[model samples]
Target: MALWTMSFLLTGCVIKQHQSLSFCETASPIYISRDDVLTQETKRQILAHDVVGERVCGWGRSNHTS
Candidate 1:
């Protein structure tokens, strides 16, 4: 069907890159509290968020945060 074919074509792209970039543009970075515990999983998540933000939004480059 035409509807089904259109939907199929619309689904193709690099995995989550578009959505992730949009999130990087609009979403705020996660805040870490001095008193909060940093588990391994929590550390990994924080690292990933910063890395993605850096790559997509260029945060932390040349002393820029946004």
Candidate 2:
């Protein structure tokens, strides 16, 4: 009984995996480049609430931090 149930569950997972691949094929492409990203000046003015001095996400300091 357990073996039969396991096989049924595995077959359902395989079918869902094929469907996911088809969905991905119809999705739009994403382009990411340094130039396409925002500049420091724009970030300061637009994302002021999220910015604190020069720290962003506890990573590096901003250009004005020094």
Candidate 3:
């Protein structure tokens, strides 16, 4: 019974450590903008570029954070 309890505690600690490490390895969101007027074609071109994640765009807003 004591050995079983120790095993359970050790397993829990390992699982918690794995979870924390995975969270740390995760990437944060990225935001990009252009300085000139953006046309629909420009936006489409930007989206068509080689990438591996989602993209979101907003206009005339003042609540963005870096």
**Which candidate number would show the highest TM-score if scored against the true structure?**
1
Put down candidate 1 lDDT per residue, 1-66, tens digits, no spaces: 999998888887436745344776586557676667999998888878877877777776322233
TM-score per candidate, chains pooled: 0.50, 0.23, 0.25
Decide which is better by lDDT, 1 or 2.
1
Model 3 residue runs over 4 Å out of place are: 1-31, 34-36, 50-65
TM-score of 2: 0.23
Query: Could you tell me which residue pairs clash in candidate 1?
Result: none
Q: Given candidate 3, what's the lDDT at residue 4?
A: 94
Q: How accurate is candidate 1 locally (lDDT)?
A: 0.70
Residue-pair clashes per candidate, as listed? 0, 0, 0
lDDT by residue for model 3 (1-66), tens:
999999999987774434353322453333445545778986566445312223222222322344
TM-score of 1: 0.50
Write out the backbone clash pairs for model 3. none
Question: How many collisions between residues are there in candidate 1?
Answer: 0
Q: What C-alpha lDDT values do all the predictions have?
A: 0.70, 0.47, 0.47
Off by over 4 Å in 1: 1-21, 61-66
